[model samples]
Target: MPLYVWLACGLYWMNGMATVVLGSVLPLAVQHLHTTYVFGSDLVFLQFVGYWIGVPLSSMAVRRTGYRGAIVASSAITALASAGFTAWPKPLPYLVCSLANGIGMALMQATVSTSLIEWFPARRAVIMSRTEAAFGLGCVLGPLFASACIAAGRWQVAFALVAAAAAALAVVGAFTPMAARDSREGPRDAHTDAIHLANRRDRALVLALFMLCVLIYVGLESCVNNFLPAVFVEHFGLPATTASVAVSAFWAAMVAGRMATGWIARKLPYRPYLILAALGTLCTTVVLAATRSVVLGYVECVWLGLFMSGIYVVTLVFANHAFPDLTGLVTRLVTFFAGLGGATLPYAFGWTLAKTGSQWADVALALFAAVLFGVVGWTGWVTKRKSRSPSERVHAAG
Candidate 1:
């Protein structure tokens, strides 16, 4: 791996850490802010608002500042916003901070995903899977740290810690060697250029499929991560500490799964691997929804994480490969939808929990998984149908 890859992974780790820690501390945040649980989850919503706002600006930021500079700037923003968490019991200030954090996340995400192509052209799938594993590792660790902070009655310190870490990452990112153009502006592949020009409709269909897949998956995953701890506490009557541990286990499985996926992607066909992952997600979510025992629920959560690990990265990588010329555009579009998902779904999850019941939360997640399975399966059908057209032409000639 290059220095840029390490820097990118570091940013992703911090991104994951901050997002998960916010979820883990939701109970405290709600109480401190004097809000309901549904409203407390708005912290996740606001951050993604900043993310959506930053997506369009990220392209210009990267162009002007260079990838390294953009990363440094975004990291600084993350640090500043995280420090704002110290203004606890004040909803307005905290919401403002969350919005800032989302913008930072958006800028960094766009730059890192785009830069990795230049960093490793041949091993894109493997690198992306591994980089997401770094994110999973952060998720695994961040909640435990947050739990400890909560236990010590200094939950705000977790935000301070995130700020300090981001500051350090910004410093490291400043020294990394990444070009302003990221090698995308160099030469064009005539074959790819021709393909993009000729197959406009196919390209549109593929892009649409990927964007929708990313949105639904991100929404489902965010809802689970943001609200799962609350479900455990409110429904199962578990302590916050125990709930945090459960979240940790879920993310630990995600780390392990992504590592495994990086290896498997080398051996398996892309479509089949995706089908298997979707199937696992669907099954695990069902079991999670049905199980009543807390121990069984924890085990199911681990499976859900493992199954859900690489879908977003794979989707991003696939879109990049499909349309190399539009790397930045595709990155922004997919990421924008993803941020939109993160912004919307957690609130919906909270709303469902508030309106219907906790049991319905799992049902909602399962439905999302089912939709993912259908969409992936539909892509394969489209490919098969398209493949048959050539044979049909031959038969007509015969």
Candidate 2:
């Protein structure tokens, strides 16, 4: 119920929204900026770099300067960067602004991610999942709104709108309180909590299992999310717009799935819920592989979104409980690679599809699904075996 928590949530939404919002309109931005589409996408590359480097740095800064300063600074920087993108159409300005925005976004995600873990530890899964769902909502809303601006040929106007919106977030965040980083919570118990969270019921096996599951989950989901438009174009011989709608469905399903996970996490522990989700994902992948219908592809996309909504967050939950104190460090490490996986997987999927056919992509999905099952099954067995022990978490990290 703290004001900083509210502010952090708002920033979380903006950062999440902005990152996804650009994906839909990157091609448009490139044309408008008088640069290669690859140049505009360089923004994403820079953003990834920022995310890779800036998150841990921001966490360290937050430790020293507090989230209030870091959050406000990041917001202002991002807003200004976005404003520049809107106002200045030249290539240099565009790349500069874009990379700055990337830096700001990375700092914002890292600082806020750590702040949230601290703010709502007792309900980490539900709270994180719900807040993240707002991000999923942003992924849809940002492009939807921007696409409208594009229809009017007002790309700058759209960037201006996002800029103004981000600036407003900065204002509100400036007024929010810094979270309690005080040690009245005690170093001993804090360290204890971190340990209890880190050591899984099954020692090192759970982390290994979770990471494998995540790698597969991320691989297939990213491939589909990244390439659905192209797939629809080739497979169904549809217009780009038609394929885009399917992409929208994927994101919307992701939002819905996150909401569902938040509700389910309240009822189930990490292991069972993920098992069911992975299993369901496996079934959907099977259906997708067997069918050649474009409609079925869309349906498969929805189910993929459903499972993915929780996959990363669930991994985060497992990580947090198993590694509380090192949460930021661990998050940056894992997410950096996950981001790498997501970025690269799509091209691989597309390349294979081009060489062979659309059917090969399903093999990738099914392979990913199989990986998830192996992960979930192994984790379940390990977790169950160790439930009777006095402590569940150990320091075995994957």
Candidate 3:
């Protein structure tokens, strides 16, 4: 493996930890800030709003700074904002810090993903799955760290650790070797041209379907992560510390699933893999909705995490393969929807949870999972239909 790949993994590991930092400590943070759950959700919303704003700007950042500079700058911003999160124990300041952290995370994520796709185009899916496994590893550890801090009545320390990690990544990004922009571009292939020549309507439909998948998948995952601890506490009467462990278990399953996906994706077609994963997610969400046992709750969390693990990464790889010429644009657009989903869903879930209950919230998540399954299935059918040889199409017509 290349040294840069290891650096990318390190960056992703930090990104994963930062991604769930707020969620892991949400209950304690809210109590410390003397705020409500709704306020916490609002902070989540603001952070992802920063993500929404940052995606397009990330492209500009890349253009101006190149990959290394963008990575370093984003890391520095994340480190600063994460530190700011605990500096003031007020609502407004925390909100501002959350938004800043979101922007930094979005910029770094987009830059790293685009670079990896370019750098390892031949092994895109496998490499992406591996890096995402690193992300899952981070998610698994983040809540455990937060849980320990919460147990010690030092939940704020989690943010400090995130800050320290991001700062280190900033230093590493500065010194890491990266391919120059002009040097990374590969010659266009016939498959790329074939995609360009395909029916415009079909192409648009495929992209739309994939984007919808990204949006729903991201939203559902974010909602679950942000609120699972609360759900475990309220619905199952679990202690706050115990609830945080549920989050870790969920991501531990995710790490396992992603590690398996790197190998499974090589044998299984992307379309079928996506369909199966989506279906698995829907099943788990439904089971989770119906189950009331605390034991079942933990089981469902792990199952849900395993099923949801590879949907986002595999979808991105599939879309990139479909529209090879538009990898960068597709990445940005997909990430933009991811931000949109992450921004809206959790806040909506929080509001719904406030108005209704965890049961209804679980129902909503199951519904979203069903929609994801449908979308993935539809995308598979469309792509398969489109991919048939002209003779096959003619034979079918005959």
Candidate 4:
């Protein structure tokens, strides 16, 4: 019920909307910027590159300005960049603006992720799910906003709207009360965490597993979301409108799934729930790839979104609980690699399809699903082994 909780939700919503809105208005970007569509797409590549740059910048921002200040500053930067995108529609300036927007987006995600632990210690998993659900809701709305703007012959309005919302969020964040650096809620110091990791050899193993989980999960999810429309159009011979609807259905299911998972987290163990979700994702993806029926494809996408919804937020919550002292740093590391996956995986999927034929696409998805299962098993094993240790036993006793 704290103000920061609501602000975090708002931050996430804007972050989500900003990510896909550019793609939605890509046609306008190409026309106004006087660049080929192929070159215009480089804006996306540059944005992710900025995301990579923000990883280290966010750490420095937190060190210099604290979490609250970092969030405000990042939000302001996002607003400025968004407004600039509309102000200067030329390709060169647009690229710079997109890069700045990416930096702001990355910092916002990192700050909210680290802040959530202290903000909602007792129910971090549930709260994290809700935050991510807000993101899904933004994803669902962003296209609609862009479509409406384009329909009205004013696509630039979409960028202006994004800028206004981000600016408002920055102003609200500036006025909000927040925890200080010296607060008791502060995480363990770096030296103390290093000592604990040294004492427990498996800690490093657990962290490695977590990072791998993030990398694979992000890669798989990004590939599915970004390419599903193309798959529908090309393979099923569906209309573009129908393909778009399928994509919307996936995001809608994601929004519902996050809420459902948040409720499930209250009763079910995170591990079992994740395993169940993973199993469902594997089934749906295989079916999706194998089927040609539009109805079946739509159904599969819904189920796929439902299962995919829980993974990212849950992984983040687990990492925070596992390494509370290193949440900011660990989140930045995981998300930095996730950005790489976002940039690379779709290209990999396309390259594989082009080289080996489209049949290989399903194989790729299935392989990734198998990898997800393996990661889950590894996580469960690591958790069980840690539980058997004397330190864990003593902690359990307390």
- Candidate 1, residues 1-398, lDDT tens digits: the string is 55676777888889888878888888778887778877766777888899898787788888897777888988999999988886554888888998998999888887788777555555667777778998888888889998999899987787877898899999998787774333433222111111232377877887788788788888888887778888888767898878877788889999999988778766765666667888899999888778889989899889999898988877776667667788778878988999988888777888787677778877887887898888877755554444445557479668
The residue ranges of model 4 lying beyond 4 angstroms of the native Cα positions read 25-43, 84-94, 149-157, 180-201, 238-242, 350-363, 391-398
Clashes of each: 0, 6, 0, 0
Please list the Cα RMSD from the true structure of every candidate, rounded to 1 decimal place.
Answer: 3.9, 5.8, 3.2, 5.4
Give stretches of model 2 more than 4 Å off: 26-46, 80-101, 153-160, 181-225, 289-294, 347-366, 386-398
* lDDT comparing candidate 1 with the true structure: 0.79
TM-score versus the correct structure, for each prediction: 0.92, 0.77, 0.95, 0.83
Best by lDDT: 3
The candidate maximizing TM-score is: 3
- In the range 85-150, model 4's lDDT, one tens digit per residue, is 878877788889988987898888877777776656667777788788988887667667766776
What range of 10 consecutive residues in model 3 has the weakest lDDT sum?
Answer: 188-197
Question: Considering lDDT, where higher is better, how would the candidates rank from best to worst?
Answer: 3, 1, 4, 2
lDDT of 1 at 352: 82
Runs with alpha carbons beyond 4 Å of true place in candidate 3 = 180-197
Q: Pairs clashing in candidate 2?
A: 197-321, 197-322, 198-322, 199-393, 199-394, 200-394
Where does the lowest 10-residue lDDT sum fall in candidate 2?
A: 186-195
174-199 in candidate 2: lDDT tens per residue? 77667554332311111111222224
Alpha-carbon local distance difference test for all models: 0.79, 0.65, 0.84, 0.73
RMSD of 4: 5.4
Off-target runs (Cα >4 Å) in candidate 1 are 179-198, 384-398
